[model samples]
Target: MHPYDTIVSRDVDAFPLGEFLDYPRLMSVDWREEEPRMLSAFFTATGLPADGTTLEMDDRTSYYQLVRGSDRVDVPWGDEVSAQHSMLVALQRVFGASHSIRYLNHGCADTASFVVETNEDWRRLESANPHVRWFFTPIERLPDVFKSDIDELVRVGETYGGA
Candidate 1:
């Protein structure tokens, strides 16, 4: 199991292009083909040279790495509910909905991956967004190491109020 998982949009245009322009780190992923207009706007909003911001991956593996990296470090993408909730809040701020977001299980799922500290945190996240649907493999079915990490996160959340 990978340490982290990624959430991406099946339809790139589902994201709020205008709102995302303000997030420099989040906008660092290559989206030239996915949404050129939004990418252009992001560059303009951040004052980043358009040519400089355009990321060119040499292969599909590199592209996947970049996308996963961006998800791990950027907004609305994290292993834990808080991180995901933060993303949801950001989307709501832009008047966006939940139809396009998808969780990718294969990219990252290591022990160091993000996750809620406790079951309560997970419950809260679910309660907060009843309509949101998470698509990923079940925790019990994951490798022992990944399961242990998740268990540790739950314990941490129980003891420290979250990781």
Candidate 2:
């Protein structure tokens, strides 16, 4: 499976995900500051940081949003075909549970469009306000060791003179 699709199938913790994504455009162009801020407050209330995070809005609803920097992106909240709210179950029907998975965004049928993170627990937010409407690919950290290797290469090139 694609990394984003896999993350949506499951979930990862909220951390710095600014490096691995694009604008996730195609949302309603009419946006308000409160929408992103409200979601940010909801997440911080739930103990996540103010940025680079994606999680469900609440338990009852299927809405999920990504609050990265000052922006937000809504993941597919429904099958867009049925009344299903739980995207995992919805997507599983389209992509199957285990083997024989398929592609994400084709010209028309985007099977992976139904993916979402099923890991949120609303107990953390004291008020637990359901945002009702809003939307991931969980962005995995580039391995920590990779940075040190890059630094080492830079040092070696400076000393021995060849990259």
Candidate 3:
């Protein structure tokens, strides 16, 4: 079955993004085919921060709900590192983990891989949108190590070596 066969990702090699191998995160995404509004949903799903401004909203939870409902809404990822990582993870979830190359790639393929974490912020994001019930199609869970989703983000983040 292909990655798009279901909203969730399987541990098989059904999807292959060979052309995306070098993109890291930002470039790999074919945003023309993806909805950027999903970024907020990604942030909420991964339990990461969007920005300090987002903190000022009177009803942030409701605001996020609105953001998740549409793909045209624009969201500014104040934390560039986390935002890019979230997006990359989202893609891997849509794809698979075996695609991770020998080294400097996404996943536990090397010691350079990093870990995905969950903390208090999860509550806020969860309130905004529950991970289980939220996220668009082709994404069934938060960016995780199970698929090296978080590791892939870290590899791309630092592998550039100040890129």
Which candidate should be chosen as best, given lDDT against the real structure? 3
lDDT at 17 for candidate 2?
Answer: 27
Counting only residues 3 or more apart in sequence or on different chains, how many pairs clash (N, Cα, C under 3 Å) in candidate 3?
0
lDDT of 2 by residue, 17-111 (tens): 22222313111111122234433333332343444444435444445544344444443432232212222222223222221111111111111
How high is the lDDT of residue 22 in model 1?
A: 36
TM-score, cand. 2: 0.18
| lDDT digits (tens) for residues 1-163 of candidate 1 | 1111122332323423334223332222221113233345344433445442332343533321112213321232224423223332222222112111112132233312212112343355445543212322222223322223555433432332211
- Model 2 regions lying over 4 Å from their true place: 1-51, 56-62, 81-163
lDDT of 3 by residue, 68-111 (tens): 21222222233232333334443334323322111222222322
In the order shown, the candidates' Cα RMSDs to the true structure are 15.9, 20.1, 15.0
**Per-model C-alpha lDDT, please?**
0.29, 0.26, 0.30
Task: Please identify which of the two predictions, 2 or 3, would achieve the higher lDDT against the true structure.
Answer: 3
Cα error of candidate 1 at position 32, Å: 35
Q: What is the lDDT for 133 in model 1? A: 23
Best by TM-score: 1
